[model samples]
Target: MVAIDPEPLLAAGRLAHEQLMNDACTITRVGPPTLTRGTSVLTPGASTTLYSGACRVKPQRIPRNEQASERLTVVARYEVALPFSSVATDDLQVGDTVTITASGDTRLVGQKFAVMAVDFGSHSTAWRLTVEGAT
Candidate 1:
């Protein structure tokens, strides 16, 4: 009986994933918000950049619209994939924010998203993040 090593396969997968990513993204860990008069204020204390590099951003779902009176709200969901070695698996949190600094699609650039979930596994070639934002 022989045991085959999986490192080579994993390395190849990582390389392929990196080559497909055409966008630049930045992940930021935001500081705790301040509470004032029983309300949470979004005044950011300090932020740390967890990762900044090439990434792939894909639309998870079509933008949905909700109308209230004369105001309309549109919500968009996206999935971001980063190279396996882009950042440590434990460094990203659910509440962390991802900003797409540059992308081949002009509409995607300068868009910010709130991280809703992080997906990773031993065999994962890239880190997948589910994010949502108002379009």
Candidate 2:
């Protein structure tokens, strides 16, 4: 049996996924707020762009009983997937922010989110990000 290269196959799969269901997303680095004397100032930082993106943002799914019993405030959680070539995996950290444009709604543009986790597949050309609402 001869060996076959998987790079081309992976690239094709990524392309198909991108073209079919991807949107635009921006990942911005979060830096510590600067403190001057006795005051603290917060500001936005540098950001990188991803042309093809997959973002899932919705309210946390929990049983109504459980939510009420625990007094759990269900907030929106975001999961974003991007092609491996878009940005370096190392550049995305837990504190980074991701702003994604809603696919069909212009009124929901630039929804902000905070990165909670970053998962990179060992053999896949994609990055999966788990995020939550950001202030």
Candidate 3:
């Protein structure tokens, strides 16, 4: 039996998958915070733009009781998926932030989320990120 290279298949799959990623998001890597005197300051290092382009953002299905009391609580979590060509995986780290710059759903625009985890696979079409909403 002859062997078939998976590169072509992967490429085609990514192309088709990326089309569904209609949302536009900007991923920014934030530096660690510093402390002045006895108080901790949130003066993170110079923010860097890691990735900014088409992506998919979806809220994870969780129990209602797990959510906060308020409807628009900052504790909400979401999963973000971006095309592989759009970002270098190494540039994305935990604590980085993702902001929805544009989306067909107006409600998603301007929302910010902190990266909690990164998920990728050999056969994956897009990189998945678990993020929590910020206030």
Candidate 4:
């Protein structure tokens, strides 16, 4: 499923897809639905939640003692690139569940911001996401 802006300039991206235009990650928010980052056919200025198949999920089953300083291992469900900046920080842990949808070949990686926000250019992305709730 892709999201299209109520207007008529966006590309209407496809959800649940794996695209690698840049290293950044695009995403779909919870409400007001805003494609903060990445690229999409949906309205460029209309707030919305865009979906894409670009996520970083890790399964961490470490003991309590090892939780202090252990890195989580992640895998990409699809052969696609998410949208974002150089850094991504979120509370999502391993074994969490997430969903990705899209309207085009754009992608974004995010898991902490309730409100999505991209650069001045809709194409600027450079972040990764770690969504939880999936085993």
Q: Which has the greatest TM-score?
A: 1
Candidates in descending lDDT order: 1, 3, 2, 4
Candidate 3 Cα RMSD after full superposition onto the native fold (Å): 3.3
Q: Which model, 1 or 3, shows the larger TM-score? A: 1
lDDT of 3 by residue, 1-135 (tens): 999999999999999989999999999986666767566555657788888889999888552333466555436778899997774655688888899999999999999888999886888888899988745
lDDT of 1 by residue, 10-92 (tens): 99999999999999999999787665756655565689899998999999999899898998989899999998886454678
Error of 4 at 119 (Å): 16
lDDT of 2 by residue, 64-116 (tens): 32255657654566567776566555567787777776555554367777788
Better candidate number, 1 or 4, judged by lDDT = 1
| Candidate 4 ranges beyond 4 A from true positions | 1-26, 32-47, 51-81, 84-97, 100-125
Best by lDDT: 1
- RMSD to true structure for each model, in Å: 3.0, 4.8, 3.3, 17.0
lDDT of 4 by residue, 1-135 (tens): 898654233322312122334233344333334563567545434433354334433323332322225755332233223434323323322322234332243433333322222214353232333233211
Q: Candidate 2 vs candidate 3: which has greater lDDT?
A: 3
Candidate 1 — which residues are off by over 4 angstroms? 34-43, 67-69
The TM-score between candidate 4 and the true structure equals 0.23
Tell me the whole-model lDDT of each prediction, alpha carbons only: 0.89, 0.63, 0.83, 0.33
